[model samples]
Target: MTDRRRFADAVFRGARSRRSLRTPHAPLVPRRPPAPPAAPSAPEPETGLETGEPVVFDAFTADLGAGLPTGMALLVVIPVEQGGTPGFRLRAVCCCASLVEFGDVYGRPDLALGSLVAADGLLPVDVLSSMRTWSRTKKGLIRWLDARRAAHGDDLQLVIWDQTGYGIPWELFWLERAPGSGRSEGWLGGLVTVTRWLSIETAWGEVVRDYRSEHTCAGPVAAYVAAEMEHDVSLFGAYHLENSDSLHTLAKALEEGDPLAMVYVACHGTYGARLSDCVLGGVPLDRFDPRRFDRLGPAATFVFLNACHSGSLVDDAGRFRDRALRGFAEVFLRSGAAGVLATSGRVGDRQAHEMADQLFRHLRDHPGRSVAQAVRDLRAEMARMTPDDLLDVDGPEGNRRLLPLLYRFMYVFYGSPRTAVSLATGKGV
Candidate 1:
């Protein structure tokens, strides 16, 4: 109409001068977010577990979370391994200077192991000193024991403690005195350097080194519970000692076993709830059959009780005495026994040969540490240390120095899971 109103006001002034020259003058600062890279301190393996012992065994692989081995059980005093060696190599079995001279592991009876102390003595020397009882002849314990003398047979017949050239040794015990000066060692450092344990031994070197690295309760939880309790062992029967042998051949080897044959008992441990019916006359017990040739109720599966007070319980005083010792590990995991490794009192002899040579060298190099990942890596390395006095099963000093050695002594169980994974990490299962 006048050139269309001057071309629509020159297109609105050329689009507002091209948006005011793209609107920028002197004020615009907003762009942050990029600061999170500072967690690389790196120093937590102090020979704890990457397969420990300064690593170098070869063949048994299992890089870390390890796996393989569906069966297990191993107790040691020393038997470092030889004969095609694929894995398993740890041996300390007390020599770091043995201590506990309470003496006489029974056989003399009527409670005299120093007359249950208290003559003004709170010292078992702060306990947990050398712990590794028995295992010297091919690492003794039993079950096919030697297997026609290894050298190559895929060896199976349990119990080994044949130490080669002995390197880790010390102590003989008689130190009837000595308990001062920053605690030097004796009476387990006079009961772990008391002052009420110097602020928990000065924070146990930063919570066993760096507040227990991440979790799975890490650190060789003793080598992932010694390779899941020594992977894949298959014993049939013959484990009676002087009741004149013959639990009917263990029930004819639990009735020609192998519907998954897993059970090992070195013998004697006690405490109760149910499965204590005279102790290890054992197995789906209510009576006895041992399988007279075979029957295995929940399929019979795994069980191992290297004896010595099978995880000690019972302290008497009525009203289900702490529910009969916490229902003795839930009636052996509800009697079908898929896992059990007892021993809270009377365990030393070199801590059962350093816990059966680091549990068959961590299951010959972590063959996936089976049978419930070897007691949950020994109950998470016994619930992260802090014992030096272990076995209080419920206290009163575990019922005055462990209730009659775990109520009538009897041992062995492996399998019947539901609770495990503690080697030293206290606070109660």
Candidate 2:
């Protein structure tokens, strides 16, 4: 194995659990997405940041895998599109000793997140079984996972590496039915914890990651939004920045000596060549190097990229170019962030606000909640939301129902599944 693979193996080996594994039931399919409507015009500009007390996090006491599903850890590798053709696949190196599964699911070359929702909403039982079978044969790792889970318990960390910008909502696999009734059950975040990883080779080297970082707190929690997103930024109680310099300064401080719990960024995001062509204030992530903010103190750091396509990794041009990185989220990870919450495709202001509200509220209400668990809660909350919950905007009121569905599986978590922030302690779990 190469040095990067060796590093990944070590990280997962350190996190390997000793619990019994049970095979998962048939996988579930995602809820079908609604037909998309015309895109909305950009919102007006407004700027200012609302700074606040630093959040306290109890890293020493926080359990890395507390409350997480206990089962064989799973790593999946999916294919990305390049120049309208499928490119070499990205693989998920395993941390679980019992099993490491790899699969190749094809995605479009353009990497545009066409629909956030599933096509059928509910996949049939036969299809679910077929999926597992296909994964076993085509991907060549599911059978071992099944056997391990059957022997142990039905819980696994489903780590996904979507370098190609495929829009598959892996969370919606339909697993089973209610014992007596026809009522069907699906595999939402409640049952499975989905974490994303970056697989691009950079100038420094291959960006192999350590997904198990202990939580730590540096100081007070702070937030920043692009000038245009001041309205949404205020929802998170964060001050908005007018340009990239201020954002860079804060990032620099976090890397050097500043105490920062979390940074919320709301701005415009675009995808081409790669994901995260996002502009915060007047600064584009392309011009901003996240590595400049390395060694972010003892406190674990989080970055919420509340921008459309901020996490999209569509184009494959220059993917192997020496300093070329995938998206803003990857940059943050490369720079030293413990975790990042970003959207896979275009997301609206309303949806982004709803996500932020859920994330912060969960952190505020539940001290020491693992970032993975909080995100699990967030995914569950989003799954439960309906169009009725959204405010009617420019689109057809009937079509508005799709908004919540569109947001489903659009947001991805990059970093340690065990990493979490506590507003109460101002530290990472």
Candidate 3:
């Protein structure tokens, strides 16, 4: 059998054996209070057996844990077919532990999940606040995370490796409050530093990167700002490329062997029917193919695509099924960028600019914080801020606002959560 087949078989057999041999442990701490029951509807038929217990497989663990640094974990989700039914296998591994669980089979497409993505690949923010359906897969993953957090501290950094390409928006998963814990429940992304990765193959070696080395220092930045936002270009203190000619300028920078610390793009982005149609800075995304450029420049550690829908990975059907049509975030990641921060949906123009400003300011002011940690802190801060505080609005507008909370979850980071961007001097990017 091929390597892929062999690996899958081993995982399946190992999961079964492990489940049979070991008794599941109860949570060490009190479980979170259950969410209010949803409106009753016809029950969907089960497609496969549910195994909520964590399974340990040595081969899988070793492969995933080979180069994982301490305090960091990889959550691998792969779509699979068992007995002609489509399902997913969820696995997580850190330096010291491993856990695997089988997710519920997909008998039919999830309309709620599909509703998050619009026809143009942009997310409809209105659907976010009312979302109640939590997939069994998500719940199972949460249980695993709860156990991990209980054993370890909440400082763990998570790298989600999603082979399903469904664009599940893992960061926005609602976390319930632990009873008497005194911690308010919030989005998972705000609670922890989370990043994402996508690999076609099942092998861990194919997707592993040495993140420690990339966390050392901040290098030169290359900023591409729209004409209207030229005022923000000085924030990076790097070569400023106007939006109209950003493509050419970026190409020249790559060809000239310029070592860049960061590539910040502040422009308008629009989703199209296909990946090629997606536009950034008035240029088609197809023009920025990483393969066309000989190099992405040395130390190209971080990319901040501060634009609407720049981070989305969906295709024509508003789903992430078309792997070949990946978004700008994936493009930069494949181009050897250590980390990328982009938006998953439409963002208010003012909020988008403010978000970028806050991010850079936080990075510069706090020299020791990692990009992911800074993002997490910022999300939490935004979540706590009322509209009156954030937008300086009056009581009526402030009480009826949703953008502050919604905008915080729109920004998604894809890379090593622990990868630090040093700005010890606290001066420029």
Candidate 4:
């Protein structure tokens, strides 16, 4: 009864009812990432920013449960990384160079996609985050997932992202005996976002990102990618409010009793303890809820607040509690998940993407490896490019704005594949 089974009957019906449609090829991986000739400019933080609210990282920790990995509570790195040099990597099209560097390198999870074209003939399956979109030959693929769900007696976990306008070709998963070809294949599509755009001043040759779009790049590219994966996965989403219809669609899906395994919200965060870059849902923030999972099918997992503050705890003063760790990961695990990985500080988008790339590479290339080992590898690579501030620990003391600005936006998830940490706040990472 994996999440996939919960919707199996309905999904097949949706497909069989409309099998005639044009095949949408996954976007060719971008070979050359676009770049601007000049650096970027920053917008002033909105006037409503409550800087007057004293931030207490220690207090935040008390509110959250223990069992969090060290550095699970702080994410002061946004300013650190943005203040430095920026680099660009292509979107979907994986150049020959990337193909050569596949499993062990750094890349964005949702955008810089990599996949294994199953020799048995199935559409490429997104390696990282494990989502599926489009299908040239649907039969065998459907059988495979169906069998997995029934055999596991668990809901299939569907990880979704940026589905604002993406649509999946449901017919692609149906199996059929094609002429002469005994076996059928399916095409899988996934992309990793390198450096997102705040507002593309293509006019100025600049690619930037801001708090508004949740690191969403500007272009039909994102829209196209979103539409591509609309129909598959257990529960898929890279962030909340990704597009106009995202919330609406999510509400509808939940209402219809779809089992959502985990809801990953990897977006703008602050050391002050807010999942959103700006206030939302009444508390100057938004939090994850397990009770909302009415139709989780048969899976024990619920929500994942992969975004920064997702694991951060709040002290009595309402500030972040743990200066060195965020408790959201602990909460996610304590509440229950296969596991949760979170960041204590602002993880750079590029770094996050790269980490995701390595994580997925390890998962696919080295099947059955422990998630801890995967993260270990990712951390090792990230350590290679540590910012100068982190490297110069003796230079200053106590959360230097310049220091966090140097290298804190790193992505970390803290949760057992089946465990969640306790946060009195129950913010849900």
**Candidate 1: misplaced stretches above 4 Å?**
1-125, 130-253, 256-258, 261-301, 306-368, 379-429
lDDT of 4 by residue, 1-429 (tens): 544333333322322211011111232111111222222222111111123333233332232222322211111101111122221111111111111101111122232111111111111112211222222222333443333333332212211111110112211122233356333222111111111111111342322111111111111101101232233221223222222234324423443332333443334333332333221111233343222323321233333333333333322113332211113332333222334454433333334444444554564476444444354444433433434243233222311222222122233333222122111111242
On residues 98-124, what C-alpha lDDT tens digit does candidate 1 reach at each position?
Answer: 111111111111221111111121222
User: Between 1 and 3, whose lDDT is larger?
Assistant: 3
Error in Å for residue 103 of model 4? 45
lDDT of 3 by residue, 1-429 (tens): 755344334322321110011111111110111111111111112223444344334343345555666777777665554565545556676666754544444432232222243222222233344332453335666666665555556677877765544546677677665567555566778777788765311122223234433453355565677775666665655333323247457646655455456777877776655555567766666665543322442464578888766776634333333333357876666556677888775565566767877888898788778888999999888766643242333222332254456666778887667666653222442
- Per-candidate Cα RMSD to the true structure, in Å, reads 31.2, 17.9, 15.2, 23.8
Worst 10 residues of 2 by lDDT: 35-44
Query: Using Cα atoms with residue i matched to residue i, what is each candidate's TM-score against the true structure?
Result: 0.23, 0.61, 0.71, 0.32
Cα lDDT of all candidates, in order? Answer: 0.25, 0.46, 0.55, 0.26
Top lDDT model: 3
Write down the worst ten-residue block by lDDT for model 4: 216-225
What is the alpha-carbon lDDT of model 4 when measured against the actual structure? 0.26
Instruction: For model 3, state the Cα shift of residue 395 in Å.
Output: 14
**lDDT comparing candidate 1 with the true structure:** 0.25
Best by TM-score: 3
